[model samples]
Target: MRQIPTLAPLPARLPDSVPFVGPETLERQRGAPFAARLGANENGFGPSPRAIAAMQAEAGEVWKYGDPTNHDLRAAIAAHCGVTPAHVVVGEGIDTLLGLAVRLMVAQGDRVVSSEGGYPTFDFHVTGFGGELLRVPYRDDRQDPQALVARAVEIGARMVYLCNPDNPMGGWHPPEVIEAALAALPDDILLILDEAYAEFAPALPRIDPDDPRVLRMRTFSKAHGMAGARIGWAIGAPVMIRAFDRVRNHFGVNRIAQAGALAALADTAHLDRTVAQVAAARDRIAAIARDNGLTTLPSATNFVAVDCGGDGDFARAVLTALGDRGVFVRMPWVAPQNRCIRVSCGPAGALDAFAEALPHALAMARQGASGG
Candidate 1:
């Protein structure tokens, strides 16, 4: 096929890669649906009934574009967070906001730092904008902010990314630890603190709304069960927050999502119930892991990482076995971390499905062990 005249030659620098493989794609490839959909860290307990009712009530508004100012939602978020509306910027999701942040801050050949085998989405955005990566290995499975900052200073990095309650591993540092990390960064290096799981973490620290050196990211996807809503925002200094307006898609947040997030925010009782359910699910996951002679990693988020007591290959075998039998858990991508399989907190029925498949997966893992 001839290249189109209107399009320039594709950049040689960007490697072909996707940040994550969706569970739906796996179901398609396996020609079967997952009995237990616990791989993606989504809240399967579901969104609040109130949020759904609100979305339904607002369904007629779909014909109109979302408010360009996002007035009411922004105001409510500001009130909840104890910050002015100027300090908030909502987007399609943290993923989209991350892309905008990377594009705004990283110049060609600029340096970015994150934990090795950390959330790949941030790394993807960095490279998509021509920034070189400086990946520091995680310290004891938790992404170490101190190490990240040292590397950032070493490389004169333009940006650093972190997930408070990190993905895959589901580990986290308290807010004070985060405060210390903020204090450690050079003034010019921007820290994109992704707090997608903040709502589920019990040890979450309080931050003064006036903090200058950090941008605390939050999303409704986890505890609020709004993964489909695609509502995420950042809390930052007014000037920093305003910078997003220069590049963000102003009308990217849809009307249904807006109603859902606002109602979800107002339903704290439902949020508490969901958190309790997640805790119970985590306990069940731990129990299952222990029964199977697997080790479960400590988690502050809504997922657990069960050590398969072997290497990446063994864990992959276990994951495949589970998927074949209709369970859909996942594993980390790099060794050491990849030695375990990650499972999200789902409905009790889903947990039962995982419990049923795990022993068989373990047996398959052992059978394949010699091949490794």
Candidate 2:
């Protein structure tokens, strides 16, 4: 018998699992399309018209690869954020940039810190790079910045991950708290601040790009309503920004995405409108949850997390019942956090579907538990 090639130790040790199962996969599993697409925290408002136009204009030039340096987009992002171009590094999306950031900082067996139930993608990146993750639990449904810093210091962590207007719980810390946490962190450790949902939140005081201890990641995938476009940028000290280039895919960002991101950055009006719509949708979701005897966590992102009034298993049943009704949504992956199911902001039709299905879904879950 012929011997097969052996896998690398790191890859071999990992489980065959993805951080998220896309709705498309769920559709396949269910053998039917979901009636409401409100689970992935995507902007249902869609991309700005200006961005659509820009992508269309560039459609004919698909043959040309995007600028390897991502020059124009980086310049536009810098201007928008009041930072210099040297402070920006463009990538396919925050996910890719996160992977890059982790690779740049983590060595095998190096310790990292994050919330117990923080953004799974960041945790996935850390584990893939063989970094030991120390997860600090959320206090009162929000990431405990103080706990994170303490854990980082205790473990001598090389990196710490945070998400503002965080996913799953849709909670955030005040700017002062974030700044204090940053100040408390050890100089040797880098804080990877994922602000992918920043546009929907109140304007927070900016962290100085001169600070080498932090890397701020932002994206057009949220308030700009361009998740499919796959464009995100990182802001950091000039030296740290340049370091991403050493490991990033040279042509990772495509021509159309670059064009769309540039146009989206310039269209502040569309962004404002999208933010307003998301806010309205969030209110509608909260109202619906309240009417059904559930409660919603305050959200600064384009989604709301509805408390199912029970434990993780109860929320999981509710989530499952919603899926059976062709309404797709998600819940947190860990204990207390998993007591809520997340619903993304979307067009009126999508929310309407959610509103219609939720009561029946909850009823079904309760009935199932009561042996009805």
Candidate 3:
């Protein structure tokens, strides 16, 4: 037998599960296409026409590698956020940037703090870097910032992750609450504020880009409708932004994504239209849930979490039933919150498909729960 090199101690010990299973993977397993793709919280509305044109123009130039510095996109993002380019670092997406941020700050056995059922990718990165993740459970479906800060201080944690207008359950904290959390966090503790859904948020915490204690992440995946493009940026102190150059994949962001994102950023009208459409779709989803005698949690993101009026097992059944009917949706992995299924905002036709299937899915789920 041929000899193979041994894996590193860190990777060797890590779990073999991915943070999220893509809808494409599920479709492949089912051997059928989903009629209503409303699971991933993606902006099915899509990017601006200008953005499409820009990517199309860049298509023929895929032979060249993207700019290692990501100069133009960084400058544009800085202007948009009213910060200097020195305070910005662009990357493939928030996920990759998060991994880099984890690698930059966390070492083996370092203590990190996050919500119990918060964004799993952050937890995934923390564990990959051999950090100890201390979770504080959600209070009333919202991420308890105070609890997170308290736990971080108690553990002498090196990092804290908080997702504003949180995922799996789209609830948000106003500016004051987030400001209080930041004020409470110790200066030595780094706060990785994942604001991936910031565009749809009502009000955001006023954190200065110069604040060394916090690194704010924003993505083009949601409102910008460019999840497939895989581009996002982080705002931090100049020193922190410069540090990413040490370990980041210089050419990881492809040329087409860069062009598309740049064009998308410039089309303010299109972004405004997308946000409006998402808000309307959220209302429609809530209405659909109500019509089926279910309720939905308040949402400030591109998705709504519809309460299944049952436990995690029941919610899982509903999700599976929806999948069976060619309606793709998802649910939280942990308890309490898992009682709800997440449905993303999409075109009217897609929502119609979902609205049509949901009642039947629920009926099937209820039958299964009763062992019928």
Candidate 4:
């Protein structure tokens, strides 16, 4: 008898599917454009003009591959962060850096720790590499450092993941609390702090780049509004940073992206201005939520998570209603947290659409729920 044509078995620990379906995919199904793009926690304010100019000028150089060493960007980022270039390793956004972090530390079946309802990208990486995931529940919308540390200890986890200014709920733990959490972590277990929103959040707790047990990952995607550029990096002890090179796509950071990121880093004034605007927009979203009788989670990042004061069903309905109304948005993937829909900080016009849509969407969701 001939063997089955299947040449290899899928990894048991890998998820059997793609977990996140983007708003664009939904828009495609609906056959229309969204009036307000408040979903995906993106900064619609866009990248700096300096970065754009740099990218445009460098466009002619696209014929050349990027410096595989990522020398110039690394140097620029290092100087800005006050770290030595040796302590930094750039990749195709923090998502890729995270995958490298996981590969460097985790063997198949090695348990990893992250907040429940935290960033999904990290979870995707964990599953992709066949690591066992253990999620710590959030404490009042903020990712609980205490619970995460306890779980890390109990599970003998190889890695502990966190997003400082978190996604979905958009809550943050003050820096002192995070320092306390770090002190509690077992030295052998590595902490991968996802700081993609660091550019937007108020300065709080900071992890030393040279910290032996921590890897701080930041991205150009968020505050830089350079999501398409796919530029991000990790800061850690020199040896730990070096490990990423072993698994990273050496020439993955493209030339335009490198030139663009360098310019973005240089344009700190634009970053500061963007952060301030995001803060105001966050306040605006909160006001809209309140006007509609919803509670908005406190967020240091460029988004808000508005609670409809109901179950996941109601929240999902709100999400669908919002989508149907041409106001794209998202909610947490699981219970309790899923009671809220997340909205990013877009321009004022988008908020106007949201302010108008919130009441209508809620009414529609409530009516649908009543019918059932």
What is the TM-score (0 to 1) of candidate 1?
Answer: 0.96
Model 1 per-residue lDDT at 21: 88
- Pull out the clashing pairs in model 2: none
Per-candidate TM equals 0.96, 0.98, 0.99, 0.96
Residue-level lDDT of model 4, residues 1-372, one tens digit each, is 977665344364355677678878988999999999988888899999999999999999899999999998889989988899999999999888988899888887899999887788889888887788999888877888888988999989999998888877787778898899998988899998888888766675777777889999889999999988999988889989888778889988889999999999999999989998999999999899989888898898888989988999999999899999899998898788999999999999999999998898999999989994
* TM-score-based ranking: 3, 2, 1, 4
Tens-digit lDDT track of model 1 for 47-89 = 9999999999889889988887778888999998888998898
* RMSD of every prediction: 1.5, 0.9, 0.8, 1.8
Q: Is candidate 1 or candidate 3 better by lDDT?
A: 3
Model 2 scores a TM of 0.98
Report the Cα lDDT for residue 196, model 4. 82
Question: Which is the winner by TM-score between candidate 1 and candidate 2?
Answer: 2
Clashing pairs in 1: 35-326
If both were scored by TM-score, which would come out higher, candidate 3 or candidate 4?
A: 3
lDDT string, candidate 3, 1-372, tens digits: 988889999999999998989999999989999998999999999999999999999999999999988999999999999999999999999999999999999999999999988898999999999999999999999899999999999989999999998997999999999999999988899999999999999999999889999999999999999999999999999999999999999899989999999999999999999999999999999999999999999999999999999999999999999998899999998889999999999999999999999999999999999999
lDDT (0 to 1) per candidate: 0.88, 0.91, 0.95, 0.88
- Per-model tally of clashing residue pairs: 1, 0, 0, 1
